[model samples]
Target: MKVPFSPPFIDQDVINEVLSTLESGWITSGPKVKALEEEVCKLTSVSHTVCVNSWTSGAILVLKWFGVKEGDEVIVPAYTYSATALAVIHCGATPVMVDINEDFTVDTSKIEQAITNKTKVIMPVDIAGWPCDYDAINELVNAPSRIKVFNPESEKQKQLGRILVISDAAHSIGATYKGLQSGNLTDITIFSFHAVKNITTAEGGAICLNLPESFNNDEEYKLMKLFTLNGQNKDAFTKSQAGGWKYDILFAGLKVNMPDICAAIGLAQIRKYNDLLLVERERVARRYQNFFSQYSFFQLPILEDKERKSCFHLYALRINSISEEKRDLIIESVTKTGVSVNVHFIPMPMLTVFKDRGYKIEDFPIAYDNYSREISLPIYPQLTDDEVDYICTAILTSYKKVIQSND
Candidate 1:
């Protein structure tokens, strides 16, 4: 009767892959990692993939690669996990937080107003596996007025010629927007393979290179590899070759390379993604929607649109018109009933760190409104139908209790 939030689907295939990796002797960022990157390229239809230790690392690497530093600005949604904004801060750049739409994605209409000569990156997060409107965001970024506003600081930025759209697609991998996969939806997209994500590699992430046609992805991939390995000229795999001990230091780089061990899991997960994980997650989500639709208060997470489709990563069920206090009460009651639920996020301004940085919750009304009532239900490939029913009943009962108490 106990329903945990999200657990990695580690079957025999994952274990065997890891076992083979452990036996291979060359376990650190070697053949298996390369294979995983190739598989990701095939899955997302991107030209290059750079596997990293985490999505935060990948985001930071991209920021560094484009020479985002002190005084620059990176626009991000206020509703996303702090990683999105923290990536900007780590690069010594100011994170210009923007409010989100009702869909819990960045409000593209307001993006242009936030753009300035200092704006270098616009990171749109695909919250809960649902992709934001990339086409709209892209048009805004590439608009004539906005392009004129951009002032390139680095050689890489000048080459790009405009603001770079890096998708914070941490929750969306198998997702689609306007018939394009998550990676292809933006100029560049970073994916997370953390344990709770729809597809997991225990703790890993990747940067899908989808830069503009004028940019050389292959060259960028090579540079990223160098940047990730402490600015070393060669990785451990390359140095393992005979007479390859003499390597040169390229420059100061971040140590965020993914090892073969995590890549082993990523390979297995990506291989079986569409057939098993995606199907089961979608099935569970549909069942939840069917059951919850009978209630007036439930505002289900977006599953699909004409131009977009979620990977069904998280069922972010919302209780409309509820106060933050009542929402917490419902979660408490549901937990007592043996079903665990979690909020997708707390808006940036509400967080103590960002608050101290002069961001006020009142500035982002839409994001805070969504955050107050959102409760992410259990939706994973391993969840059973019986568990789904139990979750529904618990939520309904708990929600009614909170509503009646308020009345």
Candidate 2:
């Protein structure tokens, strides 16, 4: 009856792919990585994709590529994982924290208010695999008023003449917004293939490039590949070829390239993602909704609506009218029943690093509200129907106990 939270779905296909990489002798950032990038482009219909060691690395690379440097600002939701803000910090820029909407996506209205002359990028996170409002966001950035206020310091920024939008799509690889996939919905989108993600590469990420027509995506893809490999004109795989030993360093770049071994894992998973893996996750989420809806206290996560479809990465069930303390007690009770659960995140302002940097939880009221009562239930593809029922029962019983004790 034990229900673990978000285990990576590893079947025979994943194992065989990894085994093949190990046998190939070229297990570094080679064919497998390239293939995974291509597969991601095909799935998301993005023009170009660059695989990296992790989402943080990919974000930093993209931020740096867009000329985000010291004194620049990037707008991000306070509700997201720290990595989103940390990427901006690594580039010596500040993260302008904004609150989120009830659906767990960054509030577009808040983003518009946060924009300033120093704002270089707007990173909207897709919490729990739900896509954000890209159409509104895109229009906001491109609006003549916003562009007029933009101060471009670098050559790249000057070329674009406006703020950039990067989708923090770590949880939303398969999600769709207005019939377009998450990756294709933004100027650039980064997808995480972390261990617990819908598609796992053990530990990896991909940057989907869909810049405006003014910029060449194919050229940017070449530059991004070099950026991930220490700015070397040739990668390890290319250097392994005959007479390719000597190469030039274009500039100081990051060593964040994804190895073939890790890419192989995600490669196998994504091939069957749309048809099989994503469907099962959605099915489990629907079952949880069905079980929890009858109770007044249970608030179900929105899986889809008329405009968007989520990847159903996390079943972020919320307990209505409960204090944070009561939510903790309920989680404690549920754990005793052998159901492992989690909180999506603690607001950035509430965390020590951001707090010390002078951010206040009071500024992000909505983010705090969502964080307090949110409980991320397991919704992986491999979860069985029986396990889903057990998990729902455990939560119901635990909530009753906590309520009685508080009363």
Candidate 3:
């Protein structure tokens, strides 16, 4: 039997909930969507949450709402999906990519080097469901302005707003970092509820406003609400009101609203989250650690190490002391044995767009080394013990064949 990689764990509960929503007919950003947003609010302990169709849109919208525009620079990690940097570009801002630590987190030491007078935001991605060092990032944001920032191109002179810490926490939804939820760890946190993510909303995302006391997220929320729906003053809720059909165009906001269907799926998922889903994932992670503990050729994903707890999103195993070519061959071998797998990223600088933008792969050596031989194994709540065993067996058998062949 073939074992596919991560898939949604839908049950009768999820099906019934979705059907109930379908039958309700008050769908498409209605009461049900509002309830889901509230549920997210409680879960993250954040004051405000704006649900969107995807994490990319959430990230982009946050930057745009914060007035991140042309001539502004945002810092992003090199060892992340292209979406992390692409969203910054969507806001017409420059993405200064930084290298990652040995654990594949955005290296805190390197972040300071990329800051300029043009730097307005620091977009730190929770790579592999682990939070980047928030305290270090906050310190950088609070440091006395010392980066001799100069502006030559702007006629209207742009000033940096201290630093906005944007957390691209696509993989981490139920994750906790330093006794705080992932959503509450930064200025703005964007979560992915995609099929592959820990929390599956099918194809959706949420923007958490965990701002300081000075920043009132409610006003920003209204703007974002208007922004997502064609820059109109009224959303579907207001338009549905009696004699409130007419609305005015505020700003040219993009269409990125999440429907009740998507929210229904998310609502269903969150119901059993603390009761069952997170526990199961945690168990599976421990099992993987136990199984791979003795393997010298393997360096498992750093989930719980040196003060960090991952959401266990991806079982990224590093091919210790192996060439990238051999790693490819090993992955191919595993695939032949009825197990499905993939890689997390390809280091943005190596991508065509990033390379063309004058970023060199050599600039991020640590990120390159980490990416060269990492294979993301199947990880999801639905994965069973038998399936896990088969996956592990296939991996070990492939490793023996490849390593022995090389020896």
Q: Which stretches of candidate 2 lie over 4 Å from their true place?
A: none
| Candidate 3 residue pairs that clash | none
Best by lDDT: 2
TM-score of each: 0.99, 0.99, 0.95
Q: After superposition, how far is residue 92 of candidate 3 from its true place, in Å?
A: 1.7
Worst 10 residues of 2 by lDDT: 1-10
User: Judged by lDDT against the true structure, how good is candidate 2?
Assistant: 0.94
Name the regions of candidate 3 deviating beyond 4 angstroms: 146-160
lDDT of 2 at 333: 96
Candidate 1 per-residue C-alpha lDDT over 1-407 given as tens digits, one digit per residue, 9 for 90 to 100: 89999888999999999999999887889999999999999989999999999999999999999999999999999999999999999999999998899999899877878999999999999999999988899998888998898999899999989999999999999999888898988889999999898777788899999998888999999999999999999999989999999999889999999999989988888899989999999999999999999988899887998989999999999998898999999999999988888999988899999999999989899998999999999999999999999999999999989889889
Candidate 2 lDDT by residue in tens digits, 128-238: 999998999999999999999999998889888899999999999999999999899988999999999999999999999998988999999999999998899999988
Instruction: Provide the lDDT at 106 for model 3.
Output: 91
